[model samples]
Structures are given as C-alpha cells and as structure tokens.
Target: MKLYVLSAGAGLLVGIIYSLLNVRSPAPPLVALIGLLGILIGEQVIPVGKQWLSGTAFSTACAKAQAVNHVCGQLPGRQQAGQQAQSAEEKQS
Candidate 1:
C-alpha cells in the first residue's frame, strides 16, 4: 500500500539522518513494521466482511481481498509467471 511505502521511505530517510548524526534510531524494529502491516490488512478485511455479511455477493468481497493479495505478491498467477520466467531463463542457459 501507499501508506506502507511512505512509512518505509520516511523510516529510511530518518535512518540515514540518524546514521549521519551517530545516534540510534528511535524507530521500531522490522518486526513492528510487519505487525503494523498485519494490522493494516486486518483493517481492510473488515469492510469485505461487512459486504459479505450484507449479502453483497462473495465474488465482490473476494475481488476486494484479491486486490490486497495481488498487491502483496501472493497471487498464484504471479507465482506461476515467475516460475515460467525462471524456466525460460534456464532453457536459454
């Protein structure tokens, strides 16, 4: 998500400044970042859940969830494409 990227960029910028100043970063660790990402995803799930509960159709809710999955690079299609590319590279080699 844009929020995650912006947060990461800000953290990186702050980290560089901290290194230049020879001071420890006050920022949380990578684990905390992962936890924050989980929370962000969990928050998005609520809306899809509400849509499902309101009988808006499973496909619609799934589409919303799939968008998140795709953005996170967890989609099977993406995985297959990577595998195909790797196979092609191996064949050429």
Candidate 2:
C-alpha cells in the first residue's frame, strides 16, 4: 500500500509540473482527473508493487492453522501414555 501511494504521489507531482509547463491554457478537468485515477490504479495492478497481498494468503493461513490444531488436539493424552505397561508398573510401585 505504501509503495502504491508513493508512486501515485510521484505521478501526481510530475503531472502537475507537466501541466504547468503547458501554461495551463484551458486545462481540461476531466483529463487530469482521469489521468490521476489511471496512475493510481496502475500502481495497484502492476507487479512493480508488493502492495496487494496474494489471494491465497488468508486461505493458506486458515488451512495451516486448522492442520496444526488438528494435529495437536488429536495427540494422545498424558493419561493414555501412563497406561502403557512400563509406566503403569512405575505408577503401581
């Protein structure tokens, strides 16, 4: 997001300078507005930026978390471990 915003700002500054160089002779409002919008959108859509996160970020995160929980939660309890023959003998003594 920061990169996108910065690029847009630089584009706007350049646009302003270029417009001034033309003496602002009957400057078109729509042209400036549309140009700025185009620059902003281009900044976001282009791979030159890391602003937009991957679409799979959230989905992959969710799957990893669920897998971790499933593995942890299904693990044998200490009580079950202690019921093994060696552990049971130790406990009985």
Cα lDDT listed for each candidate:
0.71, 0.55
Q: State TM-scores per candidate.
A: 0.33, 0.27
Task: Give residue 72's error in model 2 in angstroms.
Answer: 43
- Which residue pairs clash within candidate 2? none
lDDT of 1: 0.71
> Model 2 over residues 1-93: C-alpha lDDT tens digits?
999998899967876876777735245788677666665545334332232244546435434334333333443344467568777799899
| Tens digits of per-residue lDDT for model 1, 9-89 | 977876786678676645458745764576556656776788788887876886755746654657548878999999999
**Model 2 clash tally, residue pairs:** 0
Give the per-residue Cα lDDT of candidate 2 at 61.
Answer: 46
